[model samples]
Structures are given as structure tokens and as C-alpha cells.
Target: MALKILSGCINCDMCEPECPNQAISMGEKIYEINPDLCTECVGFYDKPTCISVCPIDVIITDPAHIESKESLLEKFKHLVNTDRI
Candidate 1:
């Protein structure tokens, strides 16, 4: 599933570097994740790095936008703009 930043975000800016897809960005008052670019770190890491480092547990799975692992992999491939993934 693609992730979303909840209101719990502390805006620490830590998650930005952790996202391989460059999906996370600074919003008006908090960090936001671009669902179109997020692959939940499927093709790049063993786990979602943003979730691993977010101190406030702000990043979370978007249940409304859930996708399978295979789909996530496809997303990762697209985000990286490569077929090698």
C-alpha cells in the first residue's frame, strides 16, 4: 500500500531522505507522501524506511489505496523510471 502522513507528523524531515522514490516532501505544516510515487519501499528496501525512522509514527498505510506486493513493485519500477526493478 502507498503511505500517507497522518496528523501525528512532527515535521522532523527525517523521512524525506529515507524515501528512495523521493515521494515525501514538505507540506504547509507537515511532510506529505505522494501516493503515485510511493511503493512502500518495495523494490528498494526490506521495509518502509520512512516508517522505520519516523519518530511520531506519522507515516501509515493508506487502507483506502491498498495494493498488492506485485502492484507495489510495478509502482516502484515506474517511480524509478526503469525496467530493471
Candidate 2:
């Protein structure tokens, strides 16, 4: 699943740069993760970098956009190369 930054975020700016897919961005009030670009770090690392670096641990799996690990890897490949199958 994609990760969501909860409202508990303290805007510490620790999670944004940690995303391998560049999915995290500064929102009006907190950091936001783009579901389209998020892969839970499946293809890039053993765990989500954003979650690891978050000072407050506000990141949570997005139940609304649940996806399998295999699918997340596929998405990561697609993101890096659209021509890839």
C-alpha cells in the first residue's frame, strides 16, 4: 500500500527527500505522499525510507490504496521506464 502522512505530522521535512520515487511533497499543512508514485520502497529498499526517517512516525499504510508487494515492484519499474513490461 501507499503510505499516508497523518495529521500528526510536525512538518519536520525529514520524509520528503527520503522517498526513492520522489512521492512525498510539502502540502498546505503536512507532507503528502502520491499514491501513483509510492511503492513502499519495494523495488528500492527493504523498507520505506520515508517512514524510517520520519521523526514523529506519522506515516501509515494507506488502506484506501492497498497493493501487493509484487504490484508495488511493477509500479516502480513502470515509473522508471514506461516502455518496460
* lDDT tens digits, residue span 1-85, model 1: 8999998788888999989888899988888888888899999898999999988787789987899999999887776676465
- Candidate 1 residue pairs in backbone clash: none
Model 2 segments beyond 4 Å from truth? 83-85
Candidate 1 accuracy as lDDT: 0.88
Task: Tally clashing residue pairs in candidate 2.
Answer: 0
Provide the overall lDDT of each model, using Cα atoms, as 2-decimal numbers. 0.88, 0.91
RMSD of each: 2.3, 2.1
Off by over 4 Å in 1: 82-85
